[model samples]
Target: MTRTPASRRDDYPVFRRLQTRWMDNDQYGHMNNAVHYALFDTAVNGWLIEEGLLAETGAEAYFLVAETGCHYHSELAFPGWVDAGLRIAHLGTTSAVYHIGLFAEGSGTAAADGRFVHVHVVRGTHRPMPIPEAARQVLARLFPAA
Candidate 1:
């Protein structure tokens, strides 16, 4: 089967720098596969919080992870830093698909790439809700041009 080429830093519009913890490494001496998903979650949610789109508490609406996926191109080990590049692949009324690329610091090619799907929902009810206009505006910055 053919494989999609790994993404590059230039493909994403926003980035978050994250440090790999010692515990992140597995017996093989490389970062465990699960950590890649954590980094992706951190990058996207951290961006949202920084942009004032999400609140840690008492928010009327917030996002919940509906799905996640990853493709590894190389190994990432602990005692290093990673740059997670993010972009919006799809924007719907109540959900958004995020594309993330994890690259070693100062590297142009991605070490891993992944997709995260978030569903906007009411805080208490947890019912799907339209993405807030304010949040949409901020998210638009990372969306690809028409």
Candidate 2:
């Protein structure tokens, strides 16, 4: 069973431009599936870290991955640059859903789309933590009221 991707360049709430490394491509001549998740993680975490929301000291204040999945729409190979888009689709008391779109540079639509859910938890205690107001502010921008 195949699912169509719902990602487009325009659907991305935030853009993170990335350069495809030569090593990203597998012998099959396309970027491996695992690489796409790496890109998605990079884009999302980079945004959070840059925004000072997910820091080493405060990382536990943020939850780790609870669920993740990606849908491939087209082949993207090495030497090609991509603009990774990020957005929040759902926000919960202790979890959040992020939608990531991978677009080939200059393309209007997405090459791949992914959804990741993370449940915030305490560092050592491993208990669910409430989503901070500061983090909510960022997520709100990506998930405005409909």
Candidate 3:
């Protein structure tokens, strides 16, 4: 497979600042690879909540991750922060792809970057459903034209 380069923070329109805990680091002296995926999940879900598209209570529809991937460019260690940048790569009726860049605080290049594809599903049935208009409106802001 062809290698993709790491993204810059500015390439994404939204960002969430996340701190690295001491426990996040591994015996190797750097943040664990699994932690990167956790950060990506947290960033996306946090943005959804911030946009009022997700609720702890009864939400119109819930999203389930269908796919996810990451490419690490550098190391992240404890005792610092990460600014996770988010953007929409593709938007579909019931599914959407989110691009995430994990940049060390104040760094211009990404330490790691990834993609997540979420499918909107019914609350009870857990079956795929069309994305709500309100959610769509919020997600559209991640697009460049918006």
Candidate with best TM-score: 1
Candidates in order have lDDT scores of: 0.92, 0.84, 0.91
TM-scores of the candidates in the order shown:
0.94, 0.91, 0.93
TM for candidate 3 is 0.93
Per-residue lDDT tens digits of candidate 2, residues 1-146? 76685666667667899999999999999999999999988888888878877758745565688888998888889999999988898899998899988998898888899998888888888689998888888777777335
Better of 1 and 3 by lDDT: 1
lDDT score at residue 74, model 3, on the 0-100 scale: 96
Look at candidate 1 and tell me the lDDT of residue 38: 92
Evaluation by TM-score, superior candidate among 1 and 3: 1
The per-candidate count of clashes, in order, stands at: 0, 1, 0
Better of 2 and 3 by TM-score: 3
Which digits, one per residue and each the tens of the lDDT, describe model 1 over residues 39-123? 9999999998889877668878889999999989999998999999999999999999999999998899999999999999999
Deviation in Å, model 1, residue 42 alpha carbon: 0.8
What's the ranking of the predictions by TM-score, best on top? 1, 3, 2
- TM-score, predicted candidate 1 vs. hidden true structure: 0.94
lDDT tens digits, residue span 1-146, model 3 = 88788898679888999999999999999999999999999999998888887756687678999999999999999999999999999999999999999999889999999999999988888899999888898899998544
The C-alpha local distance difference test score for the whole of candidate 1 amounts to 0.92
Alpha-carbon shift of residue 59 in model 1 (angstroms):
2.1
Which candidate wins on lDDT? 1
Clashing pairs in 1: none
lDDT of candidate 1 at residue 24, scale 0 to 100: 99
